[model samples]
Each structure stands twice: as structure tokens, then as C-alpha cells.
Target: MHIEDHPVLGKQLQAPVKFYFNGQEYKAYKQQTVAAALIANGIKKFGLSRKLVQSRGLFCSRGRCCSCYMTVNGEDHVRTCMTRIDEGMIVSPNLEDPVIRSDRDGD
Candidate 1:
């Protein structure tokens, strides 16, 4: 949940933006991240682990962990906590295993 009653940042003036999650439209602040917006809307689960199939959500909230990884605009393994919300953007949980590119493979 967002800190609407923050002792320091109470109800700051942030531009509103619209985005889609799993095809459903959602409203978010222009400066907010996808994870933050989702949490503000009471969405607890972010994505499921590819191996264990367990639900995961924002953990570190600092882009240090994979707990916030999701799909954004057809891109996989997106760190939602680091990605700022944009107008008309599409976001979805990463349902499958993330494809890791190895440096051994020629780029």
C-alpha cells in the first residue's frame, strides 16, 4: 500500500497516468513505479516463481532482488520497482521462467 499518510510526503502533487495490467486499466502517478501502483491498489502478489510456482511480491523495493520482476510492454524480467509508470504502458506478471542471456553467447 502507498504511504498516503506519510509523515514526510503527505499527498504530494504528482501527475496522474493511466496504464494497463493484464489488460485492465489502472491509474498511477507519473513518478510511481509499477510495483508501487499495484500495491497501492491492494495487489499483494506480483508474480509466481517459475520453479516452485509460489507467489511473490515486492521484497527489496530497491531493484536488488528478483521478487519484483515482471513483464512490461512485452519485455521480460523487468524490474518493476525500477521502472517508472508511463501513460498507456502495459504490465503483467512474469508467468514463465525468465530467459537469462549468457555473456558466453556472442552478442
Candidate 2:
């Protein structure tokens, strides 16, 4: 989660700003992710289990795991690990559609 002198993203990240999450406003930076920004601000509960609906959050900072899945800008089941946060972006928790997931399972 260290954005300073990043190998690819570089050091262009700037000061933080207020952004909307669901309905609440949160302060985030242009370099941080919706999950990373949220976690750094003392938020651990990002979403719930798909079947049991148990509270879950960022397990691994890397994108290998899907623990950080959430909705961004009205889309559903977006992996927060790979998605960058944008100003005024809306973040929320939602389930992935079983049928669509099944169809895209191997691809």
C-alpha cells in the first residue's frame, strides 16, 4: 500500500480529498485505493460473505484474494484490489451474480 516512489505509479500522488462512500463522506487520496484508503482510516469491514453474509474485509493487500470485493459507481462485485479509487466514486457491498460468475468461471 506504500505509494511513495512506486515502481509504476510513480510519486505523482497528491493530497487527500473528501469522497463519497455509499452515502457517507470519507477522506481519500488520489494514490490510494478505495479499500486501502478505507482501511487506513480505521475501517476493517469492507463487505460480507457471499453465501453466509459474514462481515469481511481486506485479507491480502494483493489482488490474489477476493476479500476486498465491492461495488463501485453502481457496478457490482468489483475487486477493490485491482481498481483505483476516483474522486466522488461510490463504494458499496453487493453479491456477485451466480449465473454470470458461472459463465465467466474459466475465462
Candidate 3:
């Protein structure tokens, strides 16, 4: 859930923007970052660790940590905490494989 009324910022008044996460549609404020929107939507786990395969979530929230990495619009390894939300943007959990292979690779 978002902060409707911050002690200093007061009531947050922003336009709603629609985006997709894991094939599901979610709404977020225009000024909110992708990570903030996901948390507000009740999504805690952003992706899995490459080695341990453990769940990864928001940490640091300052774009300094890799814990909030997610795939955005076919781009992998995106820092959700630093990326601003955009309408129609597609976000998904990062895959274990850092390299994304396409059928064209013929692997």
C-alpha cells in the first residue's frame, strides 16, 4: 500500500498509471518507481538469486543493491528501485540465467 498521507509530503496526489507485472495488470502513481509500485501491489519477491536460487526482494531501495533486479520490457537486469514506472510497461521476475536466449540462437 502506498502512503496516502505523508507527515511531510502530505496527501499524495498523482495520476494513476497502468503497467503489467508477470502478465497481470497493476496500477501505480505516475511519480512512483517500479519497486514502490510493486510493493504497494503486495509483491514482495522481485526475483531469484542466480546461484542460490533464493527469493530476492527490495533491499536498500536505493539502486545500490542487486536485490531488486527485474526484467522490464524484454530487458533483463533492470533495477526496479531506480526505474520509473511507465504506462504499458511489462515487468517480470528475472530469470536464473543472466543471458536471455532466443529461438534464433538455435540452442
Q: What lDDT score belongs to each candidate, Candidate 1 first?
A: 0.85, 0.75, 0.89
lDDT rank order? 3, 1, 2
Q: Whole-model lDDT, candidate 2? A: 0.75
* Better candidate by lDDT, 1 or 3: 3
Q: Where does the lowest 10-residue lDDT sum fall in candidate 1?
A: 98-107
Tens digits of per-residue lDDT for model 2, 21-101: 668888778767778877766777877787887888888878888888888886777788778778888887655443454
Error of 2 at 78 (Å): 0.9
Q: Per-candidate RMSD vs. true structure?
A: 3.6, 5.9, 2.6
Off by over 4 Å in 2: 1-13, 95-107
How far is 76's C-alpha from truth in model 1 (Å)?
A: 0.4
Best by lDDT: 3
Q: Candidate 1 vs candidate 2: which has greater lDDT?
A: 1
Worst 10 residues of 3 by lDDT: 95-104
Candidate 3: Cα lDDT at 4: 81
**Per-candidate TM-score against the hidden true structure:** 0.83, 0.71, 0.87
